[model samples]
Target: MNAETASPILAPPLITFDRVSRHFGGAQGVTALDDVSLSIRRGEMVAIVGASGSGKSTLMNILGCLDRPSGGRLLIDGQDVSALDTDALAALRNRRFGFVFQRYNLLHGLSAAENVEMPAIYAGRPAEERRRAAHRLLGRLGLQDRAGHRPSELSGGQQQRVSIARALVNDADIILADEPTGALDEAAGAEVLALLDALHAEGRTIIIVTHDPTVAAHAGRRIRIRDGRVVADEGDDRRGSPATAEAAPCRPGRSGPVRLLGDVASAGRMAFRSLAINPLRTLLTLLGVVIGVASVIAMLAIGDGGREATLRRIAEMGTNLITVRAGAPGIRSLADLTSLTIGDIEALSEIRGLAAISPERNLRTTLRVGNRDYTTMAQGVWPDLLVARSRQLAAGSFFTRDDIRSYAAVMVLGQSVADILFPGQDPIGRQVLAGRVPFEVIGVLAPRGVSGGGTDQDDVVLIPLSSGFMRLLGRSHVSSVTLKVADAGDMERVADEIDRILFDRHHIRNYQIRSSTAAQIIMSDSQRSFALLLGAVAAISLVVGGIGVMNIMLVGVTERTREIGIRMATGARRRDVLIQFNVEAIAVCGLGGVIGVGLGLGSAVWLRRLGFDVLITPMPAVMAFSCAFLTGLVFGWLPARKAAGMDPVRALAAG
Candidate 1:
């Protein structure tokens, strides 16, 4: 029926539902609302009455803009609402309608004034203006004395009254009440009905959906629905005459542009307060993240230190030196040569770019001084071996060219060997037995610490190569050849040349040549593999941490469902609801990441003090931060979406 057939038109209808039907699930699903048609004019008080399962609540949902009609044209202030998407619909709901529910739907942790101010906050109202509007509305609703009370502290009727003030705070043109008196006792319900009557008297457009005939009697017009269709429309005498009145002019409220900013600030404050209240949970959450970060940092630091030390030791051994030992291909093993003769040394010296060449040979033998005998490594080399091999003599003198020519029985002992043979006495002039052969102790080499392979260099005796070969262990072949290249840059080329020369001399083909670069490559590959393995392990821990964040956020959403319903019922758009919860999740994760970084750095320092080389590089820190932030954003999506996509009616019904 048209407006003229029912009653004389005063102002344009604020809302109209034309042949609307909504269904759930697939094509065979049940219909929630079917072929419902109605119109509501500005400054009109209408009641939708029905028993349970009469489609009354579904109609209310459409009117409040909570759901879109599956079929039909629905209009609000001449705008076809059925054509809007989810975001546009939410925007229209926020800007054009106000809702009051039966259970009050107040945010449990917020004060009465804050609850009222929520709509203005979502409308982007400035803080001071929102405060002033909230205060004015609360005062108008007679809640000024109860502004600081939380929902739990207020009576049912008072809570509903606070919700009404929140609805009106946005100064919306239409007020939709869905079972507003349902949870109240007779006395409280009567007070709420009277309040609605008063607002209608002030020329506000009000729609109330209720099952009680007494509540419906207060409306200017009554529409009764059954089985998803409106069956009756009747005018009530108590609502005054419709024809004699002029339309009330719409007045725009003050700008609320900063409302969203205020809401963000408030949500942040609440998050901080919650964290402070549950200190133990917060600390425990941070602990998991902290340990993961600390392990990563310490491992890196130690690896870095070890790499540096190795490089330093390589430099000290002299980059110009090239050593050749007899070993299987790809494996380093000592050669079993009887001697490296003067002829072999001369042959190596003839190679181009060779600075020096020395024949090195060693034997495991016992040295006897008086009654004491000690087992030691007896090495034989050229007079220039000290300079060629980077050895330093600490006492007396190293063997000279004359000593080599004379085949002298004089020996230069390493620091460890000297200590054992001489004890506290000077052995420079004393003679010692080398495998029962008399040999004079002439010099002692300085102590050299252990190598990377854990071998001590200061446990040997040095004698002239000629004397070691002719007098002690008489054989022709040398153990190995040690060469000093003229130029360090030519080491690779010279090593190749040497390999060729030795292979030609021995009549062997395909001999492998080892170099420092090969050793470096092996070490680098090992480190990279180890680092990747450790990083994968760390990533797993991060995933667990992310899951923890998601679980907690889901719980938060469940606990705050009523709060979400209240905000949506006011003027909050779905995005506002989504953002508030998302921000809270991100704040929690970000805070945990920062604490983790601090702990990681501290752990690295502690490891360094314990003599483990660790390198906590900036890359890990950046990666850790990114992981934490992204964990919050990615995992928080499901819970935040659940909160945002909630049906306001169902949410309020939850309590």
Candidate 2:
């Protein structure tokens, strides 16, 4: 190859069109650009003059990468536009095309400087660099003083100038101005035209789309477009095939981690500013998420608390223990006593693996202490119960073996019974009459408030077995036999043995013998399933909240359709728009999550104060917050995609 041929000193044309066509509908639809072939060399100042319905605007849309050609391929600096995805196309526009429009298209929430820094933001420029570039460009454009002012605060001419500064922020290679001075007065319009002339003189490719002859005169070359066709051209029409042309080396836009962070920051700021536009609506939307998350956490907390309490109760009753009732549940009165007798209990106590037995019988009668008459429940139990049931003595010693054998009329009052019978005095030696039978109070059991089964644990009296059966109740058979087995693993075997011994002795089919451990397992499993069901119901709120977010975002996309188009025309990638909307949704959900966690915890505390069990673990809150964030992402995607897929020409016209 010749040295000159391989030198790579000469560059391809900056922009090209190969018989490009842009049509709106099917065969009978409007043809915006019909078989338009064009190419502009680097630094050329070309004017595309056309009437309102002409194809100049359509050509501009294609050149800016805001719209695609229907019939032919477009090439930028020898790179086929069709080969790049939506995001890559946006990156190219951000780096190469600077746009100035008649409507200005300045973001209302951003200051002049910030609006000028937008393309740089997409270009992965840091905050400091974007600010520095914006200031420098504003100074050059004679709008330095207006840099901090928003578009609404600036005059029409000032807004137009700020937009020009924005177009130049990334040092874009091509400046596409669509009636740049159409909205300005004669003096202001002349100033903008002169600015364009200066930029053209500095070797920046300038393309101005306009119908006015006065504006067209400022360009070095004029191309007239009529009926979606280029009727005339005054500049180079040379075109190169994109497939064969040497491709220009372009930087992969913002690919590094640092650049990714910068883009995230930009999206965050934009989303936040957009939220500020409708504060009440944002708050309402956030409220939905907060309530949903709080409900989930709170419901789980309550369910877990109840389950834990029940488990503790079951655990308190020794797992190695077994309970045998005379008859099935609901066997209440002594008159309804079953075939169970003291002889049957004595036989069961001899079974292998049997550790100890406590035959309990109860009597309910009006007992008199001093001049006060009160009704109390009395249980006939032995001293062995103190260790077997984990009971503690508050005062005095329990009855010995002699008390049961002699049928002594002595009793030990529960804490609740003592409080009612003795009041502020000691009950260790007090005599209380039970159903006209006098009984001596020997000791007081310490308070055991309430059991897991909702039974009042502190409201009974314990006396000797002989006293309750012979003296108090005057019954022959015992109430129930509770046995403690030697090995926890043998509890099941011992329960079956008791059932077999009782069935043979009583010659009755009605009886029940159960292991507390089995009951614990059944209770735990049932409670767990219930908690899960409750959580699932609460989770429905999260779904509803996510739907609300999607609805709001969809409305936002509709309301800001024009703004999205403006950004697209100014070199924003489709991903940039998508990220911006997603950022907004996530921000809402994240903030709501924080608030919801606090609310859930506070609610738990309040419920506990009201005597309800509430277990507040970090897992539920974390899971709820995570779900809320994911909800935003899932729901926000549709609106973001819709915004990204919009047609720039149609959007701008709607605005």
lDDT of 1 by residue, 1-655 (tens): 2223344435666679999998888699878888888877767789999999998888988888777788998997777988887667665666667788877777776789988887777666666787888888888878889999888999999999998888787676578888899999999999999888777766667899999898998887999998888899899423322542333322333344454566668667666755665677666655655655555555555555566666666654545777766543654444453233456467778888877667777888899998999998988888767766677878898878899889999999888888888889887988989997989888888787777788878888988988998877677556666787778688888888877776666665323444655665566567666666666677677778878777876876787677676677665677877777777777777887887777767877887788776666787777777777787788778888999998876676665
Whole-model Cα lDDT of every candidate shown, in order? 0.75, 0.81
TM-score of every prediction relative to native: 0.76, 0.88
Alpha-carbon deviation at 574 in model 1, angstroms: 4.4
Compared to the true structure, candidate 2 yields what TM-score? 0.88
Best by TM-score: 2
Write candidate 2's Cα lDDT for 1-655 as tens digits.
1212332333357788989998988899999999988777666678999999898998998888877888898988777895677777777778788899999998898999999988878777678877998999999988888899999999888999998998888887688999998999999999999998888656577899999899998876789999999999874422222222332233344567887677778898888888898998898888878988988998899889989987776655655678777775566535347567778878987899766677788777788877898887888876667755767889987888799889999988889888987889988877888888898888888787788668878898888888777877676677677888879888777878888888888677466676777777888999898889879987998889888988988998999998898787766777778888888889888888889888878888898888887898999999999999998889889998999888777777666
